[model samples]
Target: MGTWLRRVLLGGLLITQGAVQAAEVTFDDIQPILQARCVMCHAGEAAPLGLRLTRLDELLKGSKGRPVVNAGDPAGSELVRRLKGISQPRMPMTGPPFLSDAEIALFEDWIAGGLKAGRNPPDTPVAPAPLQRPAAGQPVTYAHVAPIFASRCVKCHSAYGLMGSAPEGLLLNSYAAILDRHERVRVVPGAAGASELVRRIRGQSQPQMPYDGPPFLSDEEIQLIVDWIDQGARDTNGQPAPSPVGARVRLQGVLGEGWTLDSLPLVVGPGTRIDKAPEVGDYVEVRGRWGQDGRVLVERIRRR
Candidate 1:
């Protein structure tokens, strides 16, 4: 009887230990939450405050000055404080729809259990699924290419991307924007080999794009983009290319405030004419088109 009771007690203890181990949060558990909620404002070079949440090393390294996460002490961690709003500017910096309570609790639990970085998480989000290539012989147009960009590139390349500033001032929002640049050409009609877009994705260029990778562009997706560029990278209508729009816009803040026109991101090109230096809240008329990278490339501007 004594031996049987001891055996039963041991079995109960083993089960309890397994339960405790299962309950402890690791980086893997909270990674999806970070990718979905945090990395948008905390990846790459344009990351605000130099805080990068994309990798465990970056998270552990914290922002420019101090650590964001404090292991074994959720109350003392800046990341936890920011999420809880005990710190200034409740995080995501672009929110009212902040991280859910359950999500925040996960971080709290992870930290309290001793922050373990765990293994790396998958690079892309789970939803919307991976894109399949369009049927063969279908004219590869913006339609075919947009999904590829939306899925892989736009997170870091769009105007509103978390990188704060899109790399190389590029914005991949529309075809007109994509083709209107004066800087190094991203795409050359009928020549995929010459297109920087193709080279980067194919890993021929320095710093192969989609910046986060190992799971790079699938061959079918790469072929689609190459085919589109080879086919002149046209809009769906294939009509004469649209010209940049001209507008009279008010400046909300100083040029140093980062250029904007009517709340849309703007870029001042060398060709842009400024009759007078505009100050914050000043009104000006400008002619420009959306660059391929999705910013308004100002060609001409004058006080209105």
Candidate 2:
């Protein structure tokens, strides 16, 4: 064989050998990068989606709500999508200076290599809890709503969010932040109709929420939020939020759904002071505010 041909053949052999000898990726390979960039938002009890990336076990466990990384399927992992900005809010929350294309590819390789950074893969990994929809008629609370916001809304509305700008000054990372009384009134304890949050999500108001549309929140997901707001937007403890200023609804229906006058459903609790007992067909006027369960807690009822 010619000298030049022999050299070319030798170079090709070396390249093929290098590909065959590539080392398997391990947890140690990705730890430093995650520790520096992701650990802040993904560790401890308050981690969004309870995705603590501090250890191999935790990373394997993935987000409590969904798989952040899918073993051998980089295309399926949310972590890869976020790092590449294929998903919104993106990762490291604060970036520009975001993970480079090379960094993202390294992550893809990690996932494609069965997701064990350094430790031996578990015999049977623990599957993280799925984001289950609440059962029918279950009273909605922060537990049900927080995940929705963390996954969908906070991307633009949080301080550490992508680009770090709350488009319309709405920040929903926490219950306090969501409830912080602002001029826009994102949530109104017992009034879903009056809430800007609901309006935007329902597409009733301009610039429909989550800001990222087309694949908007599912009907079930949107209802969870509506139910939470209509149910007095309570915390995890489920205590009654202070009622919204009651409207003078002089409803006169046959007590089917609502109104002492127009038939609006009113919650006549043990503490309600009834005046002049009214028959089933009688008209009445009710004065009350929002109750813990979202119904109008009647303070005073008079048969009209």
Tell me the whole-model lDDT of each prediction, alpha carbons only: 0.67, 0.67
Each candidate's root-mean-square deviation in Å? 13.7, 14.9
Q: Model 2, range 26-127, lDDT digits (tens) per residue?
A: 666777677556664565675666787766778778887887889899998999988888887667554534778877887888889887645545332322
lDDT of 1 by residue, 1-304 (tens): 6999999999999999999998989888988777665675576775656888777777878999899988899999999999988986576443344678999999999999988767655343323333444466556667556656755676666666658667988766556556654654566565565455776787755467789786898888899888777776766554323322332222222232466544546688677777777755665554554455545567766655
Considering every candidate listed, which one attains the maximal TM-score?
Answer: 1
Off by over 4 Å in 2: 1-128, 133-138, 244-304
Q: Using alpha carbons, what is the TM-score of model 2?
A: 0.43
Model 1 quality (TM-score)? 0.45
In model 2, what is the error at residue 123, expressed in angstroms? 13
lDDT minimum window of 10 residues, candidate 1: 247-256
Candidate 1: residue pairs that collide: 170-293, 171-293, 171-294, 177-291, 177-292, 178-292
